[model samples]
Target chain A: MNFTNNTYLAEQLKIGNTKAYDYLMHTFYQKLCAYAYTLSHNHDTAEDIVQNVFVNIWVKKKKINPLFPIKNFLYKLVYNEFINQYRKNKPVEYLEKKYFEAVDTSVDNTTKNIEKLIKIVNKEIESLPPKCKQIFLLSKKEGLTHTEIAEYLDVSTKTIEGHITRAFKILKDKLDTEGKAIFFLLFNLDVFSEIKKL
Target chain B: MKQVEIEKIIVKYINQEANHKELEELSGWLKKNENISIFNHFVNVEYLTAHNMGNYNINKAKAAIDVKLKANKRKQRRYQIKRFSVAASILILFGFVTLKYLNFNTANQPKELSKKNNPKNKAILTLGDGREINLEKDKNYSSKNVVGNSKKLLYTQDNKTKTNLSYNYLTIPRGGNLFVQLADGSKVWLNSESKLKYPDKFIKGKPRQIELIYGEAYLEVSPSTKHNGDVFKVISKSQEITVLGTHFNIKAYIEDKKIETTLVEGNVNVKKGNSEVLLKPNQQSITITNSNSIKVLEVDASQEIAWIKGVFSFNEESLENMMKTLARWYDVEFIFETPKSKKYLFTGVLEKTNSITDFLEFIKATSENEISFELKEKTVIIK
Candidate 1:
């Protein structure tokens, strides 16, 4: 009697289920906003970019690929919006073009595979020592100096430095060489920080 | 440099705010691995990080979205009712989109009315004695215990006849469908270009069996409780479906090279050769014509039975397949002038009540003028 999640989402959306749209929005809204902010900078503009992306998604719900996660398409659309805004406001730079090309889809499929990197990266991070993890989050997410992190944790600066060294070693050692590919694709610090909250 | 300090230098380099000592160390690290290129962002990090994000009013945005979606639902529901139908009038609903047939006969009809070739409810009924009757729309004809009306054909059994089973064949041509209630009260709807052969009346202590020679048929089997525990069995070209009492659809068009039975309610067992698969409600059993193996998978049963409700609902169907379906219902042949037209995929619910011309126009519109249709006699030329 119960429909599977992907099929259910498509069928429900066909009849205009606001709850499915709501689930999609709430799950990806913040991440989309953060991505837009990286592009447009202005929060109002970022919100506008993300909102427009979602409106397009809602209008095109019938075309959604239920087999794959919807977030990948959302991310791609946000990227396209960023490129459009970039073209309007500034001249093209080679370094910017190269990095954008790094995300390029060689294949015809619009849905690119960023697959399973989030879970693997999260698991590797969670495996860090509690103090090391806390210090690591403070340093990368807060963009704090070691001395500031030391003050925040009530620890010596040298101890804070040691925790950072140990955290990187554990992450690198646990995931090994394969994790390097994952590390490259999902290199955004803010998104990982948001995951840490969850 | 000590490895611990090297980590700090790499972090500073990643942030792109490293001084001379760290920059030199990062170049050394880069030499160790050539793939460390993803870290560099050419844009000004200060501008990206310091940009103001205006406060977003969550309540207002949600309310605005809610209103838009509600209006779409109301509009879609109204459209579904107003524009929906299938290829057949006697049987189940059909198709992907809400379909309305396109009529090609636009010229004025003759006064005599018999000369007109307009659409009418028609099918062929072959009695057990090899006598064939051409059935017409809304005409009442009773041959022995069997009664035929424009809508459906009904068979009533005589209790004390003690006669053996007499098989009768009903063929619904490409332009129409046939709905028939068996002597045992089982109801069946045959799609256009389909043929069903069943016993005229159920003999006591025998299992009810019918054969779908070709095309599609949706059947609701009468419960076994009334049949003295006799199971109903439906035979398609490639597979056989056995059920105690249930509703299901079998699409076994010989041209498609695959026979599929989709269960709508209760459990049904599909058998191909020695391999048998049990299907739950909303599950489908697929049997390829050349293979004995049957594949079972879950599906939305509503899509399979949509034909009975007069909708040709397609979920990413190729143009060739859709054209074939239309060809059967409208009793027309398709001539493809371009090979690319076959590869085009469509997803929509088109009503069956629409004319063949309208359906072709819809396809042409969806293809953005890349495709156009011309009706020549009984042939539809696609260019």
Candidate 2:
């Protein structure tokens, strides 16, 4: 199955092809189940939740927009399924920690886009200057602070900050130019608009 | 605060390091919901990478899902969907499209691949002496510091000679399998129809390398600890597996759609084109030859390495695919007398020690006699 080509897959799934459905389920079952487990903390419920999301997908597949990120749709369904159980059981509560986080419905959709984008972004990231890619991965993947990244690389904090800014700028440009089709698929008008203003 | 400062504050806020005032200010900044979404993008980027999402039972989950799908259909399936499910599966389907698209010429369904006369120990080993030796089980051959005992070929390297590199090849035909040990003490279990070109000896200060010209091979690489941290690299047509010391299986058959490298132990870097996927133990990386797309997945490594144990282990493998694989092992042709039987799913283990006819019988029996097979000298007609 072509992970990047849902246009082809969407047609297959819409036709009630269980083979295609099996492929999709087989590809995503483990990851989504594990992700559900993290939220529900109940093994059976996690498995049930993941299974329900897929069952619902097979049933309601006709209503789904093929142009959209199907994987993101799957993840959103998984999230909703877990939340449905959470509402019923109340076994544990979501502790909103100290982080002043922003919630976006687009965030989940962006995740599917990010998965496809990772390959392109990684290729583009590799072509960047060594220190630049290093700093970008440190900030993004490792969640390192500018001061920590600078200390690790033995550079000034200003240099670290500069590298990060340039890294995002370069990534943004590359993604915009080469990743136009993917950008549209990943971002709705609102999120895309917000990104441009940023 | 400026936009960049707002971004910094959001990052600080997400990291849980912001003071109360900074948090209050960040909350105020997020009053415009658009900014919140943009901020969520970065937060999501962090979330996607930060989780160690563990493994789950794929077969068990799929069975559960399949049951649910079937149950749902029984209850309330649309009429159009029911009709389409019976026909129009014209999508080339999965990575394995051998017979080409039937839609191009629906009149010409695939017919008569070939005959099967059963597999035996047959291989060709070309020595550095330019001598070609035909290998069969219990058949011994020795020449030019190389000796073979039917199943395995042993190379005794001439270390004192001043040389760049000397190469030898062991080619296993479509119905043949071979085992060999290279000069570096690395053990290789070559699957049927594989061509392995290995150097007669390792260089003084270089990595040990071998090329799998085509087909599959399981390798138990000699540890770098004994060889002074030297890396061993296996190169196929489009992909390369580089390892320090690990047990891994490489299936790069030309007949197959994708080149799959499944790591059983240690670590390996499966490099194809400019992309490199580092595979931890029990993970499998598949590289599609046509599109150059690579997919990495966690697999049951033992199932992949089952051929080494002379057993077929599958988890819900399709009948057509399983027969396609079985055809190579038993060296036979599969004719689907009933095409629907091709779509039948089978699971569990079948030992290779059984005769090809017996295996087909077992399959027929296990599928509740719903599937029948006509076993001949060279063809097994499936019904």
Candidate 3:
């Protein structure tokens, strides 16, 4: 039941443990279906694509490599199956274009490196000035408005706004351009819009 | 175009909020082969982060996939049998020998008492229109607003405006348990011998309410912030619990005089008559049915909700109370031959999956042979 380790889960899958399969399904099925939905646009088609990926995993369990992260493997499989379905309907040239895009390493790298970018942002947030960090968390995490944070901290609205603005500036400076873009994408979009207003 | 501006447009496009001009710009940018990868990454990340935001019927999808997997398994089995017919015949000869050995081993052991008293995922779901459905393991039930399988029931959110709310009741009989996720995404784990009545769908801008008719239930309430600040309330016989967002357990067995509400996380207000008390994490409120007095105590919250996790955990609880809890799960009666045996306190954790005899043996050994039990049919006589 302790399948927190992807390597162990991969081994279990290879050894034909149904519990491991169920665990994988329960954990990743929803997210994978959502990802497939983005590509297929229809719910039933998306489900079929993800289901085929899982069925193939079982049918080819012997070839499972324990070292590879199961999450990325699942996403990659779902994407490949989606493309295969697309190939059956579209012309060869269109399919070739999508096939190349599908196999693009940069695209895979961007998603694979998302965890690293998130960690760097977390480190920057932790290194922020105490008052600025407090204001930032209150506004972004606690979903508090500037006035609410001011009242809670017994400070003027102007002071609370100053702390948040300073925190934003510090985070922006610490993160690279790509990191900044990903940070905006991952975090609250409202915060990004607020930065635009500033 | 700058990468940041392009990324912003991609985000907008993924969110379906891009205007005609922005869409044109995105399509133009996506014409470059390299730019398509960036757009794909954004899409992947969006899907990962906003997973719960989707309106898709995930339960239905999972059920559909399960059917496909089952069919695939059958196909694989048939293919394997065809491919290894000769090896399978020799294996079947060894299997029969092994089966004989297993039967001999089991015959030498004591009867498996747990087989009859095993708790199962079973319930009776009464729909809004008074239709009753028996739900058990591997059985599937679906309607317009709800879908349920063996272990859990899910009420899908209906986006239409409704003037009146229709209520459905799930009753967990003895030796049975059920889990239900409400239309608002709040989850309720109904313990054995419990019944819960909840709306088919929660109306926006109105307080979401549910009632526990006469049993125990652990509720993880979806936050009001997710539902336009609509508060959730749990009504029982003696008290009403109001929650903004929280995980709590309410035990209000009809046979018991007190209704106990244990808070696991977040804050909840337990209102009894005119008096209301706010409970924090690790705090519990016990309200006696006959009186207006409510007692607040500090206790281990995990022990209170251990039933949901397939364990019976006690902290110096009396043998009588322990037996009552076990009786609900095992669907057996406990009779005390020696009245003093009922007063003996026991503090230990017993796995629900274990047989009744195993628990009795453990308690007997722990009591230094002071307590003994005899299993007669469905009743355990304590001496």
Q: How would you class the docking of model 2?
A: incorrect
Give the lDDT of residue B233 in candidate 2. 91
Report the candidate with higher DockQ, 1 versus 2.
2
True contacts kept of each: 0.04, 0.24, 0.13
Q: Choose the strongest candidate by TM-score.
A: 1
Whole-model lDDT values for every prediction:
0.67, 0.69, 0.74
Runs in model 3 lying further than 4 Å from the true structure: A1-198, B1-109
Per-residue C-alpha lDDT of model 3 across residues B180-270, encoded as one tens digit per residue = 9999999999999999999999889889999999899999999999999999999999699999999999999999988999999999999
Question: What TM-score fits each model?
Answer: 0.56, 0.48, 0.48
User: How many backbone clashes does every candidate have?
Assistant: 48, 1, 0
Q: After superposition, how far is residue B350 of candidate 2 from its true place, in Å?
A: 1.5
Expressed as tens digits, the lDDT of each residue in B1-383 for candidate 2 is 79777665655544444678877787676666577655655454334322322346778888888887786675443222221223321121111111111122322322232223446778988776788888867778886667887688887657675556877888987667878988878999998878999988887568899999998899999988878788999999978888988999999878786899999999999888888889998999999886666799999887788787666666667889889778778777789988888876655465555456656655655665677888676788998
> Which stretches in model 1 have alpha-carbon errors above 4 Å?
A1-30, A33-53, A56-198, B1-118, B161-163
